[model samples]
Target: MHVRTWADRINNLREINTLRNQIFVGFTLTMILVLVFAGAFIYGEVSVLLKQSAEKHIQQTAIQANGRLDVLLKQIDSLTTQVVTDSYVQKLLLKEAKGMPSNFNERQSLLQIANNYMAYSSGISSLELYTLDNRRLFPLDDSSIKRISMNALTQADEKKGRIAWVGIDPRVSDSVLAIRRINLLDNSYLPGGYLVVHVYREYFNMYESETEKEEKNPFRSRELMLLSDSEGNPIISDLDDEAAKSVLAQTGSTVTLEQESMLAVRQQSKVADWKLVLLMPVEAATEGISVLRTAIFVSIGIAALAFLLLTLPLSTMITRPIQQLMRSMRRARFGGLRVIPDGRNYFRTLEINELNNTYNQMVTHMNELIQVVYEKEITQSRTELKALQAQINPHFLFNTLEAFYWSLEEKEESELAQTILAMSGLFRYVIGSAADNDERVTIRDELEHAQRYLQIMKMRLIDRLHWFIEADEQLLQVPIPKLIIQPLVENAILHGVESRISPGSVTIRVFSAKPGFATIAVIDDGVGMDGEALNKLMQSIEGVPSQEPKKGAGVAMSNVQRRLKLYYPNTNERGSGLQIDSKAGAGTTVSFDITIPPEGDGLS
Candidate 1:
């Protein structure tokens, strides 16, 4: 039997391993294929987009280079025209044509004029003047004399007339080579001596300084070059000479050439009949994109690793419970009344355990509901009995008082009329038409009721009784619970003054405490209570004992305590604002500090 169990266990293990292997293999293949296809698609699209972007970048560079070249050419043309028409140059040309002798003093004056012009013109290398007659050349410097001839000047002035500008000469070594002639007028007559201005190439170089200072990405490799009129001939570059030459030859509408893994942009400038080329390498342009791609691949790898680690455990947890339930249901043959031992040990899910607990709790609550119904019925019967007892005792006492009043009247006892009248008033107040159902009365009404009760008791112990009532007029109108003050006064009369043999006195005082509370205190000069009796009185007042006999002073006192608790359960510490202060053989005071409920809080 043990051998058979081992074989079955081995078979189960093999089956589980086979199932796990198939699931893992299928999931890994699907994820890998999906990731590969997505990566390929993204790479292809990004490559095409990057290429188009590079082309656009080159086109924009070309446009900007062309605009800058045009601005420089216009500025140069304006400067040349201003120099040739300068007043000083016109005066010098006029002086030379007047047949003035070629003396040192005359040459000195012309040289001074040329120096003044050079000061104002930033790129003027040399200034020269040639005459139609070969008498002399003024300010005859070495550079000016090297390439000067009388016929050459006359021919230049004839071919390109007044205000005409000649093209840049190859023989001139300056960056910018241009010459312009000004025809001198002798009192509105044209002269033969021409005013010539030679502007140097360094003027264009000054503009290059402004370009270098403009902000550009420092990481990008850039090249700026000047091309000769032979459109493909490269002259000078800010980068490698060989690279500049190669870049110039490839210039077209737009072109990008790959150098290893880097891309270059070739842009041309056609202003001044010269090409300006700019080359940028690609590695700098796509550095951010490469970093973004690397981050995406790293994130994918982390997610794949986490998924692999969590799969087997998550799958087992999900399937284990269903497998157990299926096995149990099969063994029981799907019978309803079979005892399926609580499966808390067999199940690992908290939700399933909680569901079972809730079902058990529902059954328990149903049983408790039935028990609550019986307790409520018992409580109802007790309430009815208490109500009946309250009614019988009050009615019997009122009837006895009425009979005694009639006997006194028959005997013609006129002196007892005030006492009898007081008795009648007391009975009327206690058994009055049930209070307005609001359970509250003004302090004036409550005090009046207490006075009538004292008057009736005064008649029974004539001449031995004394009482005083003092209350603030403002507190008299404040609302308090109906019989809240009366009970304490009754207790003072029955327990303090009545229990003594010597002549006793009772005093009732009412006063306003704060804005929302009133105080009614009953004090007696009769023998006060001992500690034991006081303890019993306090316990009875607190309703500590529910048994019949132990409820001190019978229904009236107990009912008052109950009503106070029911009405204001949260009143002060001793309950209902009722407080007792006494010492044996000393007077006792029972005070009711009643809170005046708000005007609209069911208190009329």
Candidate 2:
């Protein structure tokens, strides 16, 4: 049931076009393609390796089988040599028909000789002698087909010298037989008799028993057979037509029997011309490969399952987030803006979550832009209104002050007229300008403004008030903030010299103090305040803005400090703001540094 359900789901997937389905299908198809190519490669490689291994194993078996057969056959051949050279056998074979003993006597003599040699024989168990006149002149036992085999052996043209070699014959029953001719001592016309040795076939059978015991294979069986190379011979075998034809034509290493579904490995006998062939079924030859095939099937299934299990969920994790992002984009295309589905822990990857955060921030910034535009419109309206008022006020104030100055001048009130003119210029210079306090002015402008204010105050106390202004001509053109020096000079006149009886001297100095900077100091030689007053002034400059008049005696000085901070702004590193030093009845000095050799762009 589960298998059927999986099959149904797989069949249904071909009809769907969704992202997740597409991703799953593409990944599955790719894995299947790789596995299919790999399986074909593995199949070919494994089959070739097994077949070559089978051939090598059969070659070794042929060698080993031939070795055992050769050792026994060699021993039998050696025995034949020893028997032929024996004096007793020679005497029995050379005896003429007239001089030959009676049958009983001959039997006794031959038996004695045969027994002597047979005692030491390795494979042969019987020896028989035949005379030219008799079919059997032997003291040994023979098989029932003696007459037929003797005639066959006697007529064989393979006879050489007084003796000759024979092979494992097909006609005779499971034995090797040889014949020897006895020649006259001095003549060559006729031989006296023949000697025949019969070797039992039990030695060959012993090899089969050993081969079976050593190899206990039950999957397939093998058989060993010896076949003569003679024509018109009768022998049965499992060899198919191709193998049989090759073995008959010549010796070879291996042949496949298609008809019998078998394989043959052949070895030619060195002792004779016979052929030894080892037959094995094709089914048995591939038995090991069948087992490997089963294992490969199991492994393939396991590997496929493992591959899907490990990668499927991971691919979905990656593709799922991308799919969700696409859906959000699709919604955003229709609507104004749509937020992607997201939370703090929305994604397993921190990078994905960060992307979500940046997208959200972009949206937030986009929404804030609307309010920013409205605020900008209101600010623009107020700036225009202020611009209109600024255009009218300074002109009216300057004209009215000019009229008062001329009236005072016509009455010979030159000092008073000068004061009015200076005041008028101060008002017009400050109010008529569009530049703010933070904007840059030349040192020449700031110093001249301070001098005008001092000149106005000097008229009130002509005897006690004295002042000096000193500045480097080159430093005069450097940028400074407007009204900064004038306010400090005003504070010194009212607060430093207001109660002093001695002629007080106020000095304004400007000069380069370090690389890329210039200092401006205002000094008043009046009765200086105590430590408490100086500390309060310092606190007010530090932005405390003290409300008590006694502790906050420096509203103008504090304002100057704030302006310095706004203009210079490096309080911690460069000591740019106001520095104050005072002693009772001695003096008070307020000094500050501004960046010099200005970039000239200034604070526009």
Quantify all predictions' global Cα lDDT against the true fold: 0.62, 0.69
lDDT of 1 by residue, 1-604 (tens): 9999999999988876754465666676677677767766786678667767765775576566667655655665565556556675566557666765455665577687667656765666666665545433555642342364444455446645333333344467553344344566544646545545555544543124534545463432343444343334444455455665655566443444435333444434443456555555555445556865786687668767776777766656655654555555566555432323475565367875664455446546755776898899899998998888767555567677778788888888756865776777777676665443456777788889888887877878787788889998867777767876677777777777777888888898988666666667789987887887777777776667634443236356667667666766655555573577888999898776667667666343
Model 2 score (lDDT): 0.69
Provide the lowest-lDDT 10-residue window in model 1.
161-170
Question: How does each model score on TM-score?
Answer: 0.43, 0.48
Candidate 2 least-lDDT 10 residues: 228-237
Alpha-carbon error at 415 in model 1, in Å? 6.4
Q: Which one is best on TM-score? A: 2
Using lDDT as the measure, the top candidate is: 2
User: Per-residue lDDT of 398-516 in model 2, one digit per residue for the tens?
Assistant: 89999999999999999899999999978876775555434668899888888888888888878778889999998888888777898788778877777686678889999886778
Model 1 misplacement above 4 A: 1-141, 145-352, 367-438, 498-501, 527-586, 598-602
